[model samples]
Target: MKIAPDVVRAFTPTGKLRASINTGNPILAAADATHGARGVSVDLARGFAQRLGVELELLVFDTAIKSVEAVTQEQADIGFFAIDPKRGEGIHFTAAYVLIEGCYAVRNDSPIQANEQVDRPGTRVVVGKGSAYDLFLTRELKQATILRAPSSQAVVEMFLDQGAEVAAGVKQQLEADVLPLGNLRLLPGRFMVIQQAMGCPRSRGAEAAAALASYVEEMKRSGFVAEALQRHGITGAAVAPAA
Candidate 1:
């Protein structure tokens, strides 16, 4: 696909592709002491920059909310995030390139044996603030109380500190975070599947959105996404199907 000159300018007015990367989500990216950041999203950012024939500058943030803010506010040219209507207000998202499960976890002795048991009255479910799970549960849960953590990485600790009955977030994250804090078991199945996608500020216009969206679709079709996940040793996330 031929990228129009204006579209390239929209993405790189400063002559570099500024990519907002959220290190909080773990499944997509994380703080790498030696490299600044690393993960599937980082790999994709590199790929997109190369495709646009520009330098890649990673603007890393610790939480999804911050990452989304950077892109929506146009502080960065693009970002990787879960697809949500609230976020869509200022960003145009590509169809998902990776799918992650949103699961519930409880103390091993807690009576929350299944996903169905989580929304009971008096049950307090802790989630990362402004996270995809938090946004989701806030709407779907009619009875359970939603406790917001400072960041997705802190959900497990907050759950423990507050004695919340359930902790909710990316399945892989929950699994790894709960390892040291043993006696936690993930409830059977998932509550939602997160659609991880690439997005650009809506002000970038439809052409830029189409270009980024097309790039993502090709990445999925070429097995680049699946390979990146495997190379990073990321588990419990699947390459999204064709749109």
Candidate 2:
């Protein structure tokens, strides 16, 4: 695919391509030994900058909400995000490059054994504020009340602290979060699967969005995305289907 000058410009208005990196989601990104961000999202951003022939700069944040907010506020040019309709108000997403499972965790003695059993009345679910799971569950869950934690890493602690019935988030995160307590168990199946995509501010115009969508599709077809996951030793997430 030939890269357009306008599309390159849209994604790199600051001369350098600024990518908002969310380290909160370890499946997508994490801190390297040097304390710099590295993972699937970071590798994808570097590839994007290489294609654009621009310098790449990472804007690090501890949570996806902060990362998405940075892109929407134009603090950064683009970001990796879950393709959610609520976030679409100020952002336009390209074809999803990855898919991650979202799960629900509850104390072993709790009544919630299946994914479908989590939304009953009087059940309180804890999630990271502004996370993809938070947004998804907020819309889909009518009876269960949601409690916001400071970040995804804090959801388990918050859930235990508040004695909430369930903790919901990325599957890997739920598992890691439950380890210390050693008493919580994930539901048998995932409640949702989040589509991870690259997004630019809507203000950048459709040309930018189209260009990115094309890039993501090309990356998928050429195995760039799958290879990146393997190289990073990332699991529990898979390349998203053709968009």
Candidate 3:
């Protein structure tokens, strides 16, 4: 069913459901501003609103935890982030449309040249708190000391400032901007596969969930998904079928 534009519930300036953006990438920021919102998350929310015939409201938060909280508390309808199964308990996730890889980023001068190099004792890795990379490090890299930051930028900053031996997060994001402090390098191997999806409150019923899922499938099949990625200059990655 095509979502009618008029049937979507209107959100007040301070509405119940707010859309959030990570704010670390320029593309995300531009997407938000394209629709007079604030980030890619907001743009995607607007797209959903248009598809479903609903009005959208935008919410800006500094961290992913806050974004997730907005949805859990019913302050927002959904959040956009890399998907992790462990996070499933806190909210419901639509099928994943983007695949990201978690890997280590180190300065060119750093001795670590590969993913295996990071597992050695005494290596300090910086990761954003509550991020997929953080969870991966906690569970997979037991031997390394992990430093938690509030955002991906903070993690990148730590690496740039030489605060840690490694910075771990989405490879695409890490490679987006130039690092003036030093050349950034991705470890030779991936730590985990990250599937980014839209997350809604788990309290919603199956019917609503299915409707959202079907909409995502339609976007994929109709080429809207590929177009969005390309519009953002996100090449070299395949848009997977909605998970």
Candidate 4:
């Protein structure tokens, strides 16, 4: 996709593409062994810079909230985020490029054997603050109490520490985090599907947003998204369908 000059200027005003990459979403992004951000989100951001013919400056953060804040606060030009109504207030989102499973997990002996059983009046569900799962559950769960963790990476520990009856987050993250401990198990199936997309601050105008959205669609149609997931060895996430 050829990025228009006006859209290019809007996205890269400082002659460099400033991208806010969230390392907390392990399904789409994570810190490498060397601590640099890696995975599909990083690859897409770098690819976007190449398409725009600009230098790429990465502003890495540990959570989606921080990443969204970077763009909305004008500290960065663009960010990768899960497209949600709450986050859409200040950001213009592209069509979703990936779909991640969001599920509930419980202790092995907990009574919450299914996804539908998680929303009891007294059931406490722990989620990463400012994450897609957190936002979705906050809206969908009317009865259950949601305990917020500092970040998605800490949700598992927080669930155990706070004695939350259920933990909600990316299914891949919950499984990996629980692998070392034998007492927890993921509820069968997912409660929600997170739609991961690229976004720019709404102040950047429709042209910039449209440009980025087109790029996302092209990437999906060309199988770039699917290839990126495989190349990164990312599992449990699927490429989103065409909009």
Candidate 5:
């Protein structure tokens, strides 16, 4: 894994690897009182910086779209994102290094008990604004009215606030949100599985993107990705298969 000098420059034009971290997705990153941000994304950023032979500067964001914007605008060198075609326009994504499930949750009194029941004419689904689920359900769900919250962490709360029929997001997130409230329950299965990957600005050149893709593959193959997930106490997310 010898990194070329030009490839290093592509990731560290400012002599520091600026990794855009989004805390909106708790599975990827979260704000910690002891530290500014911590999660699997932070560990991966640190690992990438170590390999690039540069200092690491984490640019914290509260939403996926914001994080994507930082990389796409070239303000940051790399970012963690759920791969989506709309975002592929400005960024080059590696094969997913992590896979997380997306599911629906609803009030116990609600009649919805299965994934298929969520797309009916009267059902209103609340999802995070500009998230993978937001983009996904927008395209996949034809009848359900889509409502957006400020962030993924806020989706369930927003759903409750609006008295929406359903809440949609990461399964872990939905579980964490509905656990304390006795009234909400998750649907039988997931609506989608998110392919979370590292990405760089497309302007960084194919060589740079390829180098990143290779780095992620190595991380997966060497068990670094799996170990990180365990270390973070993150469950319901699986390390993706090698390229």
Candidate 6:
């Protein structure tokens, strides 16, 4: 079936929303490039389009920062990123649909097991630029020397390469790839709890935000949201009640 251009353009100038996918994260990877549109985010976007009786188009970007810029520049209707209040000035966020725990990735043999260990002098913590993890580490770990990487994967790589004592990112991503690297282990506690949300251009107004918010609520109530998470091996991240 042909999707209506008007429906597709609801979030973008050209009737297409560019969805950003993190190839480094397995769950998001499954939703975008790896699964060829079969991943959870893709499914959610499709559901959003279907519920609105519109056609949807997906545009993929390599990084979350790029994705946020896409929406801010009006090149895409919406994008997904970990929700942070600091980013609110640049875009409108729908009700968050997923909860993620931000934690540290350490070498497997490292003695660091708790948050306290991360605060000790000489601890080198790596984090991605502009990520929620970066913000958390910057504010919370007073004594550690924080190293900023360009991307989540790069932070993990830096830790593995011995550039830093720890890397910080979402728990699921660490569990999927970083933990198995033999030298890496996720610390016991989360540094910050993050809610993953959809972002729209700030200029879109309250009505568009309400429509997206309502659609997310419907998806959660219908059990589709949970199913999507489960299909992607994302556990414990609950869909929040729509605003």
Quantify all predictions' global Cα lDDT against the true fold: 0.93, 0.91, 0.67, 0.90, 0.93, 0.70
The TM-scores of all predictions, comma-separated, are 0.98, 0.96, 0.83, 0.97, 0.98, 0.85
RMSD of 2: 1.2
Q: Of models 3 and 5, which has the larger lDDT?
A: 5
Q: Write the per-residue lDDT of candidate 1 for residues 144-234, one digit (tens) a residue.
A: 9999999988999999999989999999899999877778988889999999999999999998999999999999999999999999999
Give candidate 5 misplaced runs (Cα > 4 Å). Answer: none
Counted clashes in each candidate structure = 0, 0, 6, 0, 0, 5
lDDT of 4: 0.90
Cα lDDT of model 3 by residue, 1-243, tens digit = 754322233322243345655554333444344544353345567777666554566666656666667777777776776677677776777887666677788878888877888887888888888876786678888688988877766778766666688888777667753245457777776888777677776776455566667766777787877777776666545666755
Compared with the true structure, what per-residue lDDT tens digits does model 5 show for residues 1-243? Answer: 999999998888899999999998878988876767999899999999999999999999999989999999999999999999999999999999999999999888888889998899989999999999999999999999999999888998899889899999999888988999988888887999999999999999999999999999999999999998999899889999988
List per-candidate RMSD values in Å: 0.9, 1.2, 3.5, 1.2, 0.9, 3.4
The regions of model 4 sitting more than 4 angstroms off are 33-35
lDDT of 4 by residue, 1-243 (tens): 787898899998799999999988887787776647888988899999999999998899989889989999989998999999998999999999999899888999997788888888999999999998888998999999999999998999999998889988888889889878998888988999899999999999999999999999989999999999999888888899999
Best by lDDT: 1
* Global CA lDDT computed for model 6: 0.70
In lDDT terms, how accurate is model 1?
A: 0.93
Shift of residue 9 alpha carbon in model 3, Å: 7.4
Better of 5 and 6 by TM-score: 5
The TM-score obtained by model 4 is: 0.97
Deviating ranges (above 4 Å) for candidate 1: none
Clashing residue pairs in candidate 3 are 4-53, 5-53, 8-53, 8-54, 17-76, 18-76
Worst 10 residues of 1 by lDDT: 178-187
